[model samples]
Target: MDTTRSARIILVPGFWLGAWAWDEVAAILREQGRDVTALTLPGLEPEHPARGEVSLEDHVGAIEAAIGAGEGPVLLVAHSGAAIPATVALDRNIDRIPRTVWVDTAPVVDGSAMDASFEGDEMPLDALWEEELGQGSMRDLTDEQLAQFRRRAVPEPAGAVRDRPSLTDDRRLDVPATIVCTAYSADDYRSYAEQGASFLAGVLEHRALTMIDLPTGHWPMWSKPAELAAIIADEADAAAR
Candidate 1:
């Protein structure tokens, strides 16, 4: 038995998603005897009265709290827009998290907003789909998966996406990051980084950046759960070691 597999895994969902989005992947990780905590961020929960008031910092606080609550080593598995807050939280709690597994998303640099063009106090799932579809982010999802997502999706707080993140600590750049490319190839991601894509700026500056190509859609937790789980497990084990 490998004792290093003891690292706790924290899964953070992207916009319009909750902890439930990681169900399949979490179940598989659990079967492998890994501890997992899937987080439903501040405004992503249903029927929240202050949904519009939740800011990017609120999401960062939530992630920081989750990481602080864990013992030993911790690994973060962040998907899509969740990467914005996750990266800020990572900077605040760098020593606790040994590694981060970014799912089809990279860290958003300091002063960068997750969605600067987003209007209103909240953004609905349909609107997000319209934007993402143009990038082919929904390519591989099945109709059933799409329906299920639409049914469970919640409106993302505009502040969480529109507000910029602040990072005071530069040590976070030293932390290892594993980018699981789902909607695009690893080479494509590198090219974007090389081309100085603003969204990938932080990742480009990361000291230990590794990319894994797992071609699918943006929601690999539904489109390729097993493969995603395996990759996460591998990273968790590595982090534990």
Candidate 2:
């Protein structure tokens, strides 16, 4: 835990988004003199022919490759659905990462497919996501920002979303995890974990599970990049200790 050691920060964006979604946050973190790389999951490009071919395993491999690129353990920052592959990478090799910061999402348990019942190779931006992420996070954005976001937003591949993640190692639970609560409060998330919500059961019970309160909608990176970057930097420093 050398505080002065240069550490790599891998930024993972959720569905319907590419590396561009993390532009603002990555820029702020870079200004802090930390190494940062935002990943674009395979098959997420606009009009990708392999959209239906991309599976959970493929996403896991992409994240794994990124983690392997660094010389030492990197701090992973996962937003929304990207948590799926990040968890897979951690579960497969926790030593590759010092810790993970989950943004507005909980770890997806093994053998569970996120939005499993969903069909189609690509799903359009619907009302629920519109309310939770798109429009709901507009309080801090200008008309131009919202318009650009909508224009750049792409359809998420169903294969990756519907495919189930596999975790063979329990050591992933030993890896440090911190949840940045935005769409909900720390108290609300605690209650859910206390009630043994399936997705959070293993993660919430981790010895290093930390919940940081950041009141806002699901897409805090878009609405509160400065605040989000500050929180993530603080968490990374703490993890290095």
Task: List TM-score per model, in order.
Answer: 0.95, 0.90
Query: Tens digits of per-residue lDDT for model 1 on 1-241?
Result: 4634568999999989999999999999998878899999998888889787998889988998898886878989899889899999898888798899999999778888966887898988887677777878888888888889889999999998789888889888888899999888889888898898888887678888899999999999999999999999988888887
Which residue pairs in model 1 clash with each other? none
Give stretches of model 2 more than 4 Å off.
1-4, 126-139, 195-199, 202-205
Model 1 lDDT at residue 135: 78
Steric clash count of candidate 1: 0
TM-score between candidate 2 and the true structure: 0.90
Instruction: Identify the runs in model 1 with alpha carbons over 4 angstroms from their true place.
Output: none
- Per-structure clash totals for the candidates: 0, 0
Question: In model 2, which residue pairs have backbone atoms overlapping below 3 Å?
Answer: none
Model 2 poorest ten-residue lDDT run = 126-135
Query: What's model 1's overall lDDT?
Result: 0.88
